[model samples]
Target: MNEQLTEQQINAAGHLTIGGCDAIELAHKYGTPLVVYDVSRIRDQIRRFKKVFEANQVDYAVSYASKAFAAIAMYQVAAAAGAHIDVVSGGELYTAIKAGFPMDRVSFHGNNKSADELAMAIHHHVGVIMLDNFHETDLLSQLLEENDAKIKVMLRITPGIAAHTNKYIQTGQVDSKFGFDLASGQADEALEKVLANPRMEMLGLHAHIGSQIFELAGFEGVADKLVEVASHWQAKYGYQARVINVGGGFGIRYVSVDHPLMPEEFVDAIIKAIKTAVAKTNLDLPAIWIEPGRSIVGPAGYNLYTVGSRKDVPGLKPYVTVDGGMGDNIRPALYQAEYETVLASNPHAPIEEHVRLAGKYCESGDILSQDQGLPATKPGDVLAMLDTGAYGYAMASNYNRNPRPAVVFAENGHDQLVIERESYADLVHLDRPYEQQ
Candidate 1:
């Protein structure tokens, strides 16, 4: 599966160095179980995606889906790279606001937004609010009318195109919880209700099929379906959606078994599909928007863990335990996903044996990798797992009283700690003891 490290990434000590910082040194300074993001790689990815849209003559808004990894530093980096932010929750919105992200460039999305959340979005003057259902539309309209605020909104529709990915992430299917159903005439009704609201300006239609999708055909399918609905709206009401957001599910190369399409190629293919569909529909081209979370930041991140324990299971396999487990990375146990790992302390070591990577969690199922071939590992050896920036920390848990790991950025030979390691006291910071009378 070609699990060797790149030559340019190898350092004098025979260890992998990302963003000009040695992984081993980073582990020592930031402590074990650290997430190190390569800022240059993230910026380059953003530019590559944007360039393809620009070249294809597609007016687009490339929003970084911040649910992948939302932090002040990450938000700032994404904003600085000229990518609009897509926040899915109130907390994500707060983070972006604290990072001083331009509200005009931010888009808020959620399936069930509370009245307070709607009010916050109105106060912040976010660029767009992607309404997921009739309830949200009603709530947003009420808030806007009561507060005398006008909002730009997009109707999120389920296009009934089931993407090839984990079933948990599929959103465009008819029965999915995310968007308005397109097959049952509910989407039309929702559109009618949205248009009736005087305070809300319906800007567009948005659809996200699923996540971890590897082929471009699925996206093409989404584009076709969206254009079909968009044409109907134009014909019925003479109101063409100004923007069409085909939400992002561009996959990444998690292991050799998966061959994900490149970001630029995926974007180009989607653009071509949209143009073809629009040509047939005889409708004006709307500004296309994409919300890419994983592809933009996944490969740019590497999680370093210090080996802590070793176990030899008779007639089964050897187990190498690290300081972190499902608490930090739940993909392995959650999705039965595979990840490639290399020894940061000995990047050039030959793969000599197969070992199961276990996390330091109480659950027996808290494993990081199963039946993985790597160099004979020992305690204190640093292991680097590639492509962890997307969901690793964002989905992290405090299970088994394990504190979350720290996050850092390594760029141009300089390493800066972006998030401090959670301390034991930080664990119970929200707890309070009751005083008995």
Candidate 2:
């Protein structure tokens, strides 16, 4: 049995259940390579993060990083959960607008934001623009002056502390490509620039350590570093920050070996660290904002794939191929990501053999799992891949001209199709025959 599943997750038919809906039935109805989300899981994680801040009597915002998984339905669900959102691209912002989400609750972020995207964010009155570079700062300043617009902004600084990654070195120089480096005084330089522009309201500072983080030391280091920066700005420039955003990268359980802290634990630690840091300074306690993309939706999502063929190599792990491949979820092929899989019909069945879970994509690297232990499964057996809700569909492509899979939301014994499967015509909808002159 997969450790991620509980006894209650198995229905009377001996099949895995998602949000009270049977996984087998979902596969039959939606077809293979489908993505399913347990809506309650997302809702609960958001609420839990909020309650922790509220319980501590601290003001906060649980901003969902939409880049993890962006769609109109996802935006709607996030809005319903009272979550602010972080959008890196215009398409995600447009999706949130189409979902009727409040624009003021949106934060636009990107390393190199286009002029058009900045114009869109300002025109729509997005809550905050995470200024990443001096070029972007100048561009936004010019655009704001031309449009006579004003918007709240934050300086994204590289605190140089990342956990569970090779970039864990914390110093003045950062190895990332995202934000302004603090050690080089670029963060201070950017701040002075933002303050010079009347159209940009400098709210506070922002930093993202790393993704798939499992430890708290990195976050604690960042919390203290952000406060140190804020204190320096307040003392030197007489500037007071209202909000401190330590950007998202919270980890979630993709396999049994992963043991991430609860959302409450992570929030509580951050809150305490900020409070403790504030006690050492004359500055007021700023509102803490956390962006949790993977933690909020990763555990809630599952990918269902239907088995198609098999190849038994001599004395090697048998190849168990499925209908979907890198086109649907490219994490495995791109970065050698790991995930657990189970038979939808009997999630708790005894392991019969170890097989390589291969994808149907043409690429030789389209392997879903290198060594997946599973029960005896024949053709047409549905395999439920766990913890794929974060980066799966968001990175899906029309590789090999395969249409992306549909997405479904299940809760309280009901299932609703949120995103429809792309049609074959959709693959060529943007095609135009070249006319040689």
Candidate 3:
């Protein structure tokens, strides 16, 4: 029931075509359980964020949170769009580097970054390091001093304001394990330590409230809190914050009932709050940087699955199974996430009835969605799930020995395979044979 699909998605010959390519055809070519991203949609999102900041006549940087879908192709796409890239792990950092992304535009983030990881970031001369806690501050300081390096850093602070999202995804709340807490005076301690360290250049402050945030008040609350902290620090230490990396968690429409703000509207609201806070605190406005992961790629991503088996219940809910399930997208099982499903082979057909979408996984709770209406789905019918572009692929797993599906980027009537589907051999490539031992 969610109208979350991209605008460019159309019905052609009674089949779904995303970005001018038939979705069913793409499944046949790339194989089922495929993730097809509309490249134009992604580019549009990048441009949307840029236009919003530029329109406000403010210094800003839009960094694509690559943890949503850490693919080399996506990194290249972000780079081409003139957006910075945010890598949360060594693997993501390596992927961004391998994609030939500008090292100076890459930011390394994680609460528990290892020594090797910090060294990797320092070695590559990454643009900024979003330090999450005291452990990271000490580890990174030691690593930088050891290497005789001075790098730009941002202290990830917990503004103690919780967004109205799922509690599991909330990060900026006081009880969260992510950043320096403001209420306990940990933020001030961390700021002092960073300023006293010669190897660390405190560029700004960072705070991520939560993902899938719909209310603008949460954004404004954090902005106000962070600016207040910045003002205090500026006065106490005579150190001016140059940038404020307010981490992104803007919610996207997954179901029809969910009404989230547009990119421009969201950016405008946050900027207005920052301006007000800056004026109230009598502080200089710092450059705003956002790391949007879901909003940028959520609607642009469509997941295609091949119908497999079905179980009829006569009166109770019938079960419709797909070739891929929680293995390819664990959100439904993990977060009880809901999605709108359409028959790619017959998208325009009249609705027949509602059926429960069952995953091939062995778990009983591997249901993608319950009571989803479709046009008389049958075996071999291609089912496309809307708005799966954010955490679906990033959270995919190899549970039950199911190989992960391939990913493709579609645009201008063509599709490019970005990630190859896993093979049976690949499943055990790292295993040591008992016979060998």
For candidate 3, give the lDDT of residue 139: 90
Q: TM-score for model 1? A: 0.98
Candidate 1 per-residue lDDT over residues 1-437, each given as its tens digit: 24435787888877789899999999998898999998999999999999999899889989999999999999899889999999988999999999999998999988998898889999999999998988888888888989999988888999988899999889888988998998788889988988888878889999999999988888999999999999999998888888989999999988878887788788888888989999998699988989999998899989999998898868988999999989999989999888889888776788999999999999899999997778888789999998888999999999988899999998998999998999999999999999999
The digit string of per-residue lDDT tens for model 3 on 1-437 reads 22554434665476788878999899999998999999999999999999999989899999999999999999999999999989989999999989999999988989889999999999999999998889888998889888999998998998989899887999988898898888888888998998898888889999999999998999989888888888999888887889887889998888877888886687788988898889887578999999999999999999999999999977898899999999999998888898889888766667888889999999999999987888787799999999899999999999999999999999999899999999999999998858755
Q: Cα miss at 54, model 2 (Å)?
A: 1.0
Measured on C-alpha atoms, candidate 3 has an lDDT of: 0.89
Residue 434 lDDT (model 2): 100
Which parts of model 3 have CA positions greater than 4 angstroms off?
A: 5-8, 435-437
Per-model CA lDDT versus the true structure: 0.90, 0.91, 0.89
lDDT string for model 2 (351-435, tens) is 9999999999998999999989999999999999999999899999998999999999999999999999999999999999999
TM-score of 3: 0.97
Q: What is the lDDT of candidate 1?
A: 0.90
Candidate 2 matches the true fold with a TM-score of 0.98
Candidates sorted by lDDT, best first:
2, 1, 3
Colliding residue pairs in candidate 2: none
After superposition, candidate 1 runs with Cα above 4 Å error: 1-4, 435-437
